[model samples]
Target chain A: TQLLEQSPQFLSIQEGENLTVYCNSSSVFSSLQWYRQEPGEGPVLLVTVVTGGEVKKLKRLTFQFGDARKDSSLHITAAQPGDTGLYLCAGPFTGGGNKLTFGTGTQLKVEL
Target chain B: DAGITQSPRHKVTETGTPVTLRCHQTENHRYMYWYRQDPGHGLRLIHYSYGVKDTDKGEVSDGYSVSRSKTEDFLLTLESATSSQTSVYFCAIRGIGDQPQHFGDGTRLSIL
Candidate 1:
């Protein structure tokens, strides 16, 4: 079973549009990470949030960890075609010794 | 990709056959992991190693085995390939501290 769940399994939008993807979980996590994966390439780490209610920004992308540490969100401002790819959220498996459990992915397509 | 490299970028095999994927890292990271990505499932951990000759199973360890005989190499073995096991596999490594994990390009495997 997947410990984390992502909404909007697939998304398509025009460039300059804003969007947000969410990752939710019932169990609390010590840390949460977001990654972006392009076709034929492995997922690359984008950001990591360690504290609850913490928010981090990378370029036009903003990431927020839920206050309870059980959820997270990624918001992209003025999306571009280059932002098209799969977005995945992952959290360390509690008591699993650094093992990470990934969420169902969100495939985003940005059109020009 | 990062310093990590996964061998056999692409492979085709028949069911019941055996296959092995290699992951080599040059950064000398102590923690290494193997994960498989599929539609909707995002990335699922297969196995991981914390040190030489020390390995552990992940959420989807069935039909998959792993080894870490050295600090720079980790091997994933599929004793018997199955159609369900066909997917893009990724190898990742994390160094000591709060640094995020780095991923390899990944190996695309097909089981007929």
Candidate 2:
């Protein structure tokens, strides 16, 4: 089974701080996706990275895929209280079906 | 916001009782998935359906079953509720091809 592991399971930071969350896997994936879930709500898709060493930016958030397609990272710059939520990374095995394996998740709390 | 909705946003029941959670989508997506979020486990896929009357189990499917009789609805059933099964459930839908999946608000189930 393909597994994605996220580091820094819990994070607490003050507003304007910067943080980076990492996701690693032993198996290679064809593509990787990042999601942010708020309390009492389901996860929302943040971005999908498919190329090795690719980087995508969404305002203050920057996402990068590993050079080997075995890892990914999300970096948030000038984090605000609204950035508090659970961050998850997911991917499908190279040849696996449509099913996606999700990471353990990183819970972030940005205080004012 | 991908036109997905989960019924019974909150449910409280006793052990050994049968529970069914419903997922409805208006996007007419070809794939629907059910997942449970726990403290340390993140979001684990319970079941997924690729088409009408076609479904498959995920990593954690021992006590769960799923049915997709129509393109817009996917149902998850817990044969016998257990305290360990209490968690927040989410439903997601993916359109054809490799598009990212969209999710619903989720259902909170408590098994006492």
Candidate 3:
């Protein structure tokens, strides 16, 4: 089973619309991160939430960490075509190394 | 962009052939990582290095090996490539403390 799972595997909406993607896991995490990947490029770190119940905002993007530190959500307001990409959430793969376990990505397409 | 460079952004190899992908970073980060991105699996860590000659296996390190001879270079090697190993590979680097990882453009590998 996947350590981290994301919902709404694929999302397509018109520009200016809003959308939210979720990442969940059964195991507790010390921290969770969000990444965005554009076509033909590697995933870029969007945000990281280290404290439970923490909420961070990056421009129009807001990231929230669950109170239990087992899940995360990324919400984008006024989505634009430039926001089209794959959204992924990750948690540190503890007990193994300093690696991370990423979720099944959510492919977001903001159409004009 | 983190000044990370992945060699041979694309490659195609035959089964049973040995292949190596290189990740070079100019940021002189202390930590480096190799990850593979698949269609539904998102990004899976293959290996990571904490410092020179200090490395550890990740969740999917069965057919992969890594080497960190210097602080700026990390190399991933597939002793005997298989079709199942074909995927886009990414390299990332992170500095000390609670810093986010910066990634390369990624290498699209195909094993025929």
**What is the C-alpha local distance difference test score of each model?**
0.93, 0.93, 0.92
Q: Which consecutive 10 residues in model 2 chain A have the weakest lDDT in total?
A: A92-101
Residue-level lDDT of model 2, residues B1-112, one tens digit each, is: 6899899999999999999999999998999999999997889999999999999888899999999989999999999999999999999999888788899999999999
**Clashes in model 1: which pairs?**
none
Query: Rounded to one decimal, what is candidate 2's iRMSD?
Result: 0.6
List ranges where model 3 is wrong by over 4 Å.
Answer: none
Q: What TM-score quantifies how close candidate 2 is to the native fold?
A: 0.97
| Chain B TM-score, all predictions listed | 0.98, 0.98, 0.98
Top-TM-score candidate index: 2
| iRMS values for every prediction | 0.7, 0.6, 0.7
Comparing 2 with 3 on TM-score, the higher-scoring candidate is 2
Residue A62 of model 2: what lDDT? 99
Q: Comparing 1 and 3 by DockQ, which wins?
A: 1
lDDT of 1 by residue, A45-91 (tens): 89999999999999999999999999999999999999999999999
Regarding TM-score, does 1 or 2 come out ahead? 2
Q: Where's the lowest-lDDT run of ten residues in candidate 2 chain B?
A: B94-103
